[model samples]
Target chain A: MEFVVFIIAGLLAIIGALGLIGFKNPVHSALSLVLSLFAVAVLFLNQDAQFLAAVQVIVYAGAIVVLFLFVIMLLGVDQAEDLSVEPIAGQRPIALAIGAGVLALSVLFISVAADGGATGQQSVTAEKVDSITGTAQSATAALGDNQTDGTETIPNIEQLGRTLFTDYVFAFEVTALLLTIAVVGAVMLARKPKGELAPLPVIPGRSGTTDETEELEDA
Target chain B: MELTSTWYLVLAAILFALGATGLLVRRNPLIMFMCVELMLNAVNLTFVTFGNDLNDLGGEISVFFVLVVAAAEVVIGLAIIVAIMRRRNEATADDLSALRG
Candidate 1:
């Protein structure tokens, strides 16, 4: 079952990714990206990351891609792009070669490394800990997880909430600040310029357009 | 065959490569941004897979942060794009040189 799920989701993700790049229309690309996002979300669930899977769908597929489509329409840039006009000769082939190189390098690294390079994070609270070395010390215990002594697993959302509020509370608060800054920046950027775009003064002797515009306003 | 974390990692690498190629090849700013999202999602997948393999909560928590950051980034980026697009309806990534001065 797990293998079947992985294969299907993985294939869907690759297809969506290809559609995102292959489509000439930005809207179509955005829509295809939605497909890819959904597939990733499914994979998230397969990993038992239930909360993240929901966020992946809600935030990524629901919000981000929608924002892309909204912008595509609002800017009136939905028309099919003329992809044939490649000003730089051989840029596509070169970029494709670089991409293939990157893929090859990562695949080689993954294949050569033992256990896919995972550190086998230590679940210190567990009764019989694995002999594998890990960086975490009392991390699982520190999170107030009830699963330490009980056979029952702590709910995914509860575990995440505990971690966010306890261990990384400061970082969580910082995200609020980051979000506020982003909102302000977006509003400022989206706002229209207050006045006309006057041409720069031709000669320095004129003392500049700033003075000219002010004088005109005064008049 | 059992599904291992390595399978997911390899798939993510493929997704990341595709995104990189699109980012390099596509001249449209919006399309480039979409490609960037693709790469970000690929990283998110890798993080989740590792988290599962390690039986760690840190992976999902890190993904939470990433999602927040991605959201913030998109907001600012789209606003800038909108600002630029309003100035000239048919602006491509290359035309951004107008701001160089």
Candidate 2:
């Protein structure tokens, strides 16, 4: 079951990613990205990171991609980009070569990695592994008792919440502050510049800034 | 065929590579931003895979922070893009050399 699920989800993810880059239209790319995000969320479930899977769908597919579409529409720049217009000769080939090199190096590193390459102390959430009960035996561990027989391990969300609120609580508080700052920054950035407007800079290829300058000056 | 953490790590690597290439090759600023989101998602997958392998909640918790930061980044980035595009109807990444100091 794990193999089957992994193969399907991984394939979908790859297809979505390819489509994201292959599509000429930004909207189609955004939609393909949604498909990829959903596939990744499925992968999260396979790894028992259920909480992340939910957030992956809700925040990424639901919120972030939607925001992308929103911006594309609002800007009215949804027209198809001219992919063949490569002002720099051979830039695509160089970029593709670099990407392939990165993939080859990472794969070589992982295939050589001992025990799946994850190294570090598995602390906080599952501190002690009780040999008898075959489950975590930590004080702060948030193991869920969904099954009366105690066969149920720690639920992913509960443990994540516990860890977030405890050992990494300060960092958690800081994330809240970061979000607030981001909101304020966005509002400031999107707002139009007011009063005594310097004339818009002259674009190299485009002609006519007088009309726009007069319009801004009037505002 | 065993579905190991290595599978996920490999998948993430491919995703990251694709995103990097797309960001590099695509002149459209919007598409480049989407590529950035793709890379972020790839990292999140790697983080979850590691968390599962290590049998720790820290990995999952770190993913939460990543999601929050990604959200904030996208917000600010899109706002800047909107601001820039408002000045001109169409502007590609190459055209955005205003910070050429």
Candidate 3:
């Protein structure tokens, strides 16, 4: 059952990503990205990272994509792009080749590493801990047997919350500071001068015959 | 067939590749930004999968940090895009070459 769900979600994610890259219209691409992000959230749920999955949906699909749409509509930049031109010559073929190479290498590494029996993650971690500490029984005991099945048997959200407040609180506060700086910087960069949107300056000497009318208004 | 951690890792790698290809092929700044977001999502999936596979909380915890950084990136990136679009009639990445000065 979980395998079926993973396959469906993975397909949805890949298809949505393809649409995102292939679509000429910015709005269509943005919508495609939303679909892809949502599918990823489903994959996260399947993996039992419940808090991260919910955060993925709320923050990514909810806030970030909405911001994309808001900027798109606000700037009125939804016009279809010209797909005919390659602004940077020879960029396309090289990029595709590199991308393909990367994909092939990654797939090869993963398959080769998993060639041994699928003993699952718990035993692997336990073995590493045992080797480092030179105590197999105690290391396995420390890691606990609850997760031997690879399904999140513990309440992940509770464990995550505890970890955040206890072990990772400083990093969490730093992230908050970074967000505040981003907000301030964005506002500063996007703000226009008081009269920036007013008419362009008309100088008679610099103006051509076509702009004579506007120059007269300036005088 | 039974799904394994390797399967998830492979899926993420493919998605990341697609995103990189899109980033290189696409000229529109907005679309390029979308590609970057796609790549980030792929990385997030990798982190979560590794975390789950290890039965460790560290992987998902790192994902939380990644999400925060991604959010900040989106906020700043879109603002930059909007500012550039306001100055020019079109928002293609090629047009911004004046900044190559």
Best by TM-score: 2
Candidate 2's residue-wise lDDT over B2-66, tens digit each? 77778999999999999999998888889999999999999999988876775655577778999
Candidate 3 chain A — worst ten consecutive residues by lDDT sum? A200-209
Candidate 1: count of backbone clashes, pairs at least 3 residues apart or interchain: 0
TM-score of 3: 0.84
> Higher-lDDT candidate among 1 and 2?
1
Residue-level lDDT of model 3, residues B1-101, one tens digit each, is 98888889999999999999899889888889989999999999999997777556678888999999999999999888877677565646765643333
Native contacts matched by each model: 0.74, 0.72, 0.75
Q: After superposition, how far is residue B70 of candidate 2 from its true place, in Å?
A: 0.5
Number of the top lDDT candidate = 1
Order the numbered candidates by lDDT, best leading.
1, 2, 3
TM-score of each: 0.85, 0.85, 0.84
Writing each residue's lDDT as its tens digit, candidate 2 over A25-99 gives: 999999999999999999999988887898999999999999999999999888888887787899999999999
**By summed lDDT, which 10 consecutive residues of candidate 1 chain A come out lowest?**
A198-207
Candidate 3 regions with alpha-carbon error over 4 angstroms: A116-122, A126-154, A195-219
**What's the lDDT for all of these models?**
0.83, 0.82, 0.81
Lowest lDDT block of 10, candidate 2 chain A: A131-140
Candidate 2 deviates by what RMSD? 5.1
TM-score of 1: 0.85
Q: Candidate 1: which pairs clash? A: none
State the TM-score, rounded to 2 decimals, of chain A in model 2. 0.77
